[model samples]
Target chain A: MKEFETVTVFDLLIRYIKDGRIRLDRTRFEGLATYHDPCNYGRRAQKRFGHGFFEEPRWILDQCLENWVDLHPCRENQICCGGGGGALTSGYNEERIYYGRRKMEQIHASGARMMVVPCHSCHGQFNNIKAKYGLPDLSVKYLWELVADCLVWP
Target chain B: MTPENSLRISIENLERTRCAQWPHAQDNCLTCAMCSGACPVAGVDDFDPRKIVRLISMGMTDAAADSRWPWICTMCGKCEQICPMGIEIPDIIRRLRAMRARDKVPGILQDGLANALRTGNNLGLPKEDFVFILEDVAAEIAEEPGFEEFTVPIDKEGAALLTTIHNKLVNTHTDDLKHWWKIFHAAGEDWTVASDNWEGTSWGYFTGDDEAMRVMAGRIVENMRRLKIKTLLWPE
Candidate 1:
């Protein structure tokens, strides 16, 4: 940890997932959804802690619905939503969109109707991109919200 | 205090100074540099939090402030999740953003925040129209098969969960709120959507405006108090 002195991201996602308050459902809707493994989730939890850190929860999605969600540009190499780094606050309009455009293209290329974003900032940035870029049909959902929708186990 | 020990002491002090100063950190960053290491905007625009804190400790605000990393970082908070310290780096960056915002240094990206403040929602939709849009969408959801009883209530008081929606969800994706409302009805939860301070997602958080953020948060608290809600379920 570089800044604060507590609460690993690993612990948060794991505990949050296990909290039993979250649910997921495979049959709620039908469409090949893609997983936009957020930069935060891609780098923070997956690579920092080794594959073992992410195995369980990513597996949880598999358990809920196999092959329904796919990783676009894949994990460990996901695109930045371009809303971070105070960019949401930074005032870099064209560049911010330029960066977000890459991600928009990435998602568009994958053809996923919905994406599960774990981080709050990423969600904000990506949503901004979708609105301004006119890709309004794509839905970005919080990972916990999805988990809460389909909790079949304790 | 000896010369030999002085160097070590200074180094330790520097290390201590670099840790995030947020009182509410989740301890995800203490031993974890994962956020900085994994941050896409870090080296790309030289915005690494690890180095930022280190630089600050070294009296490097000039460099830190000049860094484009703040806008680059995305406030993902992924670093905290991986950090053993569990420090909420994203939160810290947000604070940094607010502080920088005070200086009037403009970036092209942050302009959307202004739109959010100007309009109740970022899409710049009028409030009256937004309300009408929400009702229309809720009615549509109700009309859908298996959603016959769904109602997207506005300003309805005394609901168990004080349901709030994002501004985007309200003005643009009214359907999403319908989904949440349907979910609430299905859960048998005593949730009612609040018309006043109904938006849970705060752009105030995005622009580094504590006063604005407080105002936004206070509105929700006030709404909850007035409505007598048991719990404030901020879906934001």
Candidate 2:
């Protein structure tokens, strides 16, 4: 065993892109897009781990897409998708969706047709919000999935 | 004019509820409503982050703990992020959530946490099915033009990185797994996953069950030690 260092897929993605190990096509995705910051990895991670990863994700998104915009308040100040802290499975789903109204508002205000989330819970919650809020055109994706789609394998 | 009506707070209860983890959680409050404005669930059930702090500072810790407000909150840290005093509101809320009885925890979260402890995954998915899904999905990835024979490495000893799976990836979003696998294939990364205890999400952390969280996290460490893998990619 080596030093036993722990890293998130986000960290690895950043490394792979920067190192040119994984090549991406910026025009892979069309239309405006936005990024949703999961609480644990964004604010909590920054406060506890000393690096919250706000810019790394945006940097990754920038690699794969051209027409992307950030939500009204992103990074540490970004709104949670309202499905974290077990709210998705807590059986308080109605309340959870209600709480996500702020997120929906941000998405609507951003005029983004696609939203990328790094956390699994946020991914699921945003999908549900999309259905409930009648944003049928709104596309939700995992940050890695977006990168995966943009990969230019040689 | 003297104050017509003022309620006295229980100093004893406030002292009892005070914990070392967040010493100034309530002490240095400027009563700014930034937290409430930042919180997504502030208005639900008449919930207010400021009110929760007021309760804790007033020695109504038990009330705050037992109230539906804390459970309603997703512990998103937005309030703490915007707080001028830099109060650890989420930490305090987690402490209060821990004080709740085990059975009293939100039902789905409680059950999922128990399942992860007993079966090494939140959904209690058996090892056989998990492996089958991995192989099946890998086969699909293999059909792609570049990847001729993609095989998922499970419990491969001495691998450089060990990635855990979020249960939903196996249960509902199996296609999502391919995204990472393709990336791994392109990056030529030597990563392996554990056959047992491969779940990445921690429901224990969600339900404020620190003991359960420790157990779940320990299982991953156990896998690392067993496999001799140095790096862990805990994406959840």
Q: Which is the leading candidate under DockQ?
A: 2
Pairs of colliding residues, candidate 2: none
Docking class of 2: medium
Q: Write candidate 1's Cα lDDT for A1-154 as tens digits.
A: 2211223333433544456433456776466666666554565445445542335446655534544555565565565678754465565666677667767777777777777765556777777778666678777776555654554432
**Looking at model 2 chain A, which ten-residue stretch has the lowest summed lDDT?**
A1-10
TM-score of each: 0.61, 0.93
Q: What is the lDDT of residue B234 in candidate 2?
A: 75
**Candidates 1 onward: DockQ, in order:** 0.19, 0.77
Q: Alpha-carbon error at A151 in model 1, in Å? A: 14
- Give the alpha carbon lDDT tens digit for every residue of B1-236 in model 2: 11221255545535643554565544677789899988888889899988888777666677888888878888889888889888888887888888889899875788888899899998999999999999999999988998985799998999998999999899988998999999999999998999999988888777778888888889899999999997899755
- Scored against the true structure, residue B137 in model 2 reaches a CA lDDT of 97
